[model samples]
Target: MTNILFVCTGNTCRSPMAQAIMQHRSEWNVQSAGIFAGEGADASQGTKEVLHAKGIPFLHQSQPVTDSLLEWADLVLTMTQNHRDLLKQQYQAATNKIYALKEYIDPDYEQAWTELKEAYAQLEDQKLVGKEMQADVIRKINKLEKKVQNVDISDPFGGNIMTYQKTYEELDNYLAQLVKKMENENR
Candidate 1:
């Protein structure tokens, strides 16, 4: 079974929800982490409520992204472009494997991925924090911005139930496509 890791900033909201939705839809061994997750933190109430409403009895504890987990995931799916770049910077080996969720589901992801890989290659990790390393990656991310608006899942933390519901619907739609993609990949 494929091991898929979903990622977000805090792991309280978006990534946990993505993990639940994807795990429910696919046969893959699914997990989630945060770029800066607090160990053993509870999943957000919004995430819990959304999944409960969907009848997915899910519980998640926040785990910080680590070398072991990076090695564990066959595919590392991030909730935002920032997370994607951060991961690739920290774990260069996974650069080829990581993708923003929207990019993975894009009809032209193959081309997008190739171009993104190229852009990522141009980045120098130490220079990324400053604007110096950004010219190329910025251009690529900007092109993606035109093709996919709100490619990052909106953070629903501190929002009301309706907000979380909307985020859930959006993620669920992409996740369905992701499940199909995984099935096709396996075939």
Candidate 2:
């Protein structure tokens, strides 16, 4: 079975919600953690209410990302590009299996995303040598940015029930896509 680890900032909102959604839809071993979560905290109330309304059962305790958890996950999907990048930087060995959720599922954005990563790396390298921003690279980044939709799953930590529901719907849609992709790969 595939082992998927969903990640976000605090673990009380997005990641747990993702874990519940995926668990409800598939038999895969699924879990979630946060980069900076405190241990043993309950999921946010809005998260609980939304999941309950959808009839998706969830039991979660916030935990910070750890080496053991990283090792357990066959695939680590993050809520945002920043979360993905942070995990990649911290665990270079596991970089191959880590991706932002949208980036992993959206083939249309793949080329644009790759070029943007390369362009950002080049820009950083130039900065280290005190060079001015290259016009071509700047142009490339701007163009690619327009092509790539925001890959972040919306955070609903302090939002009302409606807000949390919207976020849940967004996640549910992408996760449905994820299920199809996984099934296709296994075929």
Candidate 3:
């Protein structure tokens, strides 16, 4: 089973929407967290309204991204490349598993993985193998991943209901595409 973890600045907005969208649309296991710890982050009313409009049920409390969660996730799909970079820097070992959601769909991920292995092998050859170099390689891989073409889902935090609705629609569409891709990959 592919385990997916969605991340954003705060659990209050984008990530939560992604979590709910994925849960409803995909067969893969999914969860979400924030870069910053927010204890008891209930779903924002705007988020709720938007999901409700689409007939998707969601109720989420914000949780800080933890080391354990990182370890558990087979795939970490963040909202932005910066989020992926920051998390990989903090947890260098799992860099291979983390990706921006858009980047996850790219055909170039295989090439990125190849480059990462080569970078690590070079480090091993130089006897300079360390977590720092691992982290650096991860950063480079994530940069390459983000080079994959994708329209980022805009953050609708603190926006009006219309903005939330628009975001919801966009996320739902992406989630549908993602679900199909994941299913095909599984098959």
Reference-based lDDT, each prediction: 0.87, 0.93, 0.81
Q: Give one digit per residue, the lDDT tens place, for model 3 in 1-187.
A: 8888998888888899999988887677888999995889798889998888878898899998999999889998888878888999999999998888766765665676677667657656765568897677667756754554343667898999999888887777767777888788778
Summed over model 3, clashes come to 1
CA RMSD, predictions in order: 7.3, 4.7, 8.0
Q: Write the per-residue lDDT of candidate 2 for residues 54-150, one digit (tens) a residue.
A: 9998899999999999999999999999999999999998999999999999987888878999999988788534334487788889989977768
Candidate with maximal lDDT: 2
Q: Which stretches of candidate 3 lie over 4 Å from their true place?
A: 108-151
> In lDDT terms, how accurate is model 2?
0.93
Q: Which ten residues in a row have the lowest lDDT in candidate 3?
A: 144-153
Which residue pairs in candidate 2 collide? none
Per-residue lDDT, model 1, residue 129, is 62
Backbone clashes for every candidate come to 0, 0, 1
Q: Rank by lDDT, descending?
A: 2, 1, 3
TM accuracy, model 2? 0.85
Best by TM-score: 2
Residue 104 lDDT in candidate 1: 82
